[model samples]
Target: MSLLDACGAGSSSPATAGGGTTAVLNMPFLEDMQVPDPDIMYEGEGVQVMHAVYDGLAQYKPGTNEPVPLLAESWEISTDQLTYTFKLRPNVKFHDGTIADAASWVAGFKRRAAINQGPAYMVAGIKEAVAKDPTTLVVHLKTPNNAFLHYLACPWHPFAVSPTAVRKHAVGGDLAQKWLQTHDAGTGAYTIKEFVPGNYYLLEKFPGYWGGDVAYDQIRITITPSVSTQELQLQQGQFDVITKGLPIPDVLKYQKNPDYEVPVTLGGTGNAIWINPNKPMFADRKLRQALVQAIDRTPVVQTSYGGLVPVQKGFWIDKLFPPNLDPISDTFDTAPLQALVAKLPDKNVDLAWGADGGAPVQQMAELVQTQLAAVGLNVTVRQLPTAQVFDLANQPQAKRPDLFIDWLGGDALHLDTVLRIMLRTGAKPLNLFSFTYPELDKLMDEAILQPTTDKMNAMYVEATKFVMDQAIFVPLCSQPFPIIARNYLTGIVQDSDLPEVIYADKIGRKLS
Candidate 1:
């Protein structure tokens, strides 16, 4: 059967229009989103929606790490790099018609800190956030952090919330958390029109948005868990775009098809096998090293990902690492691993992949299981929901899986995020195993404080080398996220800094 026939094209009304001021774009997600609250969401799926409905003080330039003026028109850093003063953009209004000013930004920062949820650490370094004037915001950090702007540009960065909305909706001092679940208080180009968890989310263009031109009048995202169903829908004109969940084979087919536009770009995301050090089986450093050496990543990348993803050479993504640094070699003798596995009282190891990962992730997990099994270890593969996989960090050592394969990346392209978020002691959710290295953490802490990029890169290189030696994680493959959209859709550029997320406001229907 042809690939189109295999996808099972079904009949449905088109979700996109060729031309009109009231253009609508329909997209699908394979996973359910958490609450739409900006301060609380840390997942990739939710970030895509939040990015559309919220604007930060600064935003990264599309396809680059450089932070550009967004809500904040401009900013200046103090000589010590500990203080930042931002000049707020004028006449910007939140979706609720409240003015987005310095005071509102300060309130938002305070709210984020007070709530202290998943992505709060992005602003934890700030000692104080004060509005010097209606249009001026002065922030004081405990120490100098050159990457502070990049942090603000991150997808999970704290965003400006409408203080007016907060006050009106505050119930028992929840900071509008309950109201924000199905609502928006942001100053972005889009506003949340409807939110139904595990079903559908609707976003409509804000009429009062300060940002120049709003694109699609409405963004309709439905939760379609099945990739095959999504494929069928996309072919049948039910889904204008399939942002995630389509398997690599189907994606490649879309790339060849004339009716679809498949744009592929590096997602700034990569998968890694995280070893739970707290587990008795992985407690020994030698066993960790043995496991790392036993499994080859080439087959995993080529077979599971169809050679679309490159095998990770180091802990950091290719862009963040210094060019001169030597790549981590995959060549290792498996004899030691085989011997170690044979000696273990319990050779059985539990391996898990995040549920959101879909087919590619499961295939990678199964391949790894086979590789480890070949070295005498009995590996059991399990699929856990993303939230449960994240919960493993807080679970008792006995309750956690021996090893879990998960996507390890950051909202920004900075090495600080790559190291800090995935390996830092307190960075939760993504830091699945709660892996901590005082030396590595110290290096990262120092790296961010460096006055120059070269100095920071040098420090990060040392930290990467240290982590490689420790074998806390088995570096897997990094793949470019593919977005398959109808041919008429325009402005579907992927933000390099925000991995897998596109600027919803920039997307417009192509003129007929």
Candidate 2:
């Protein structure tokens, strides 16, 4: 099959020339130079890159988007979906020439759960990672987690285990998280060679890989902090594979180019303006509505953002949802603004944006202020320092934010990441939003506490609606992610949802 056919075409953007194997990326956060154990990868991008380097018990087939067997020959889950048993591919071998064994898998699982933060909490319910003799590993969960198998397919699992590898470079928190950074213990297609944090990362094809040989000999991921520089590199033939983040217009340069081809994908993340419900001013939906309605998205998107489509729904707004339509640009609609002003506290609104000082937020704050003032609302905009923003965003339930903006892509390998983190009325340990609505919180409680998938999905829809109605956040447009790459890079997936993980697949590059 043709590489384009293999990747499957989409509406967002077109694909590049060459096969979908090789890739070049301008990774901004070059601070992460090591591929930490898949079981312990805290960052989403880290886990993405680790996908190609490490094999999970299950894998997502590139074009088909189906989760199929990889290291594990087959697996079984209880009807409750709480327990999972895997039958390993007995012939697989690690990079160091050791057999991939059940003991190694169990050891990695324990180490992952012991780590304090990130998605490892998914396995908190895992009662056991018992090795049934040698080829079998059975995991028993404390609860019937429907997302267990999917979570296992994530970087957190087919756990990266190294009998001696992780222990060698283990640091700070734990041994497993540290060692996998520079070492290879898994039977993956690629191996790490040079890692200079914040500068660049280099990976080489491993002949010892158990799965199959990759066509590319080397992959270099340089940290091009500037998005403009990345766009230039792709057009200038200096790079291959560009990830989305730039405006649609900025990407047009490459998209129209006949020398090579370029494509864009809608990565699976939803970006929104985070509002702290605890703040007295934002506490009122009227004030929140005013802010959302007042800002002019046209200038903001056309000028600041390149070509990202606008979204009105706070979360999961369907294709049919309206107000923001395609081809026709979005302007600051005043009808909703008038409706909001009528419901306000009858006073002028003064607000502060808690985040690093930026023109975008500053402009947004000013725009909101101007719109409200025309209708007798007073507005004040404050830009807090980055540290203060972080502190406030992470503040305990007792002290929560009034207005803040952030990006939260849908991620719950356990599938509950969204429900458990955002909609908690109850005391969920990881309630980042700290929003407590009797009805909303109760819905979340039911969703997480429920035993069946049917019930779980139903409750999730209800809870999501609650969040939307509450407008705990001001819905903004999702920024477009555009990638540009030079020819010779082939077999690259460039998945929009999780770009970091997509580049990690063993890409093929034909050197001239």
lDDT of 2 by residue, 234-264 (tens): 4444455555445455557657765444655
Give the Cα RMSD of candidate 1: 3.0
Model 1: per-residue Cα lDDT at residue 135: 93
For each candidate, what TM-score against the reference? Answer: 0.93, 0.75
Off by over 4 Å in 1: 1-22
Q: Write the per-residue lDDT of candidate 1 for residues 82-185, one digit (tens) a residue.
A: 99999998889988887888889888888888888878877889999998988999999999998789889878888988999998998999988999989999
Clashing pairs in 1: none
Cα shift from native, residue 484, model 1 (Å):
0.7
Model 2 regions lying over 4 Å from their true place: 1-40, 44-48, 61-66, 155-158, 168-173, 176-185, 289-314, 317-402, 413-415, 423-433, 436-442, 448-453, 476-480, 503-506, 510-512
Top of the candidates by lDDT: 1
lDDT of each: 0.80, 0.55
| Model 1 lDDT at residue 332 | 63
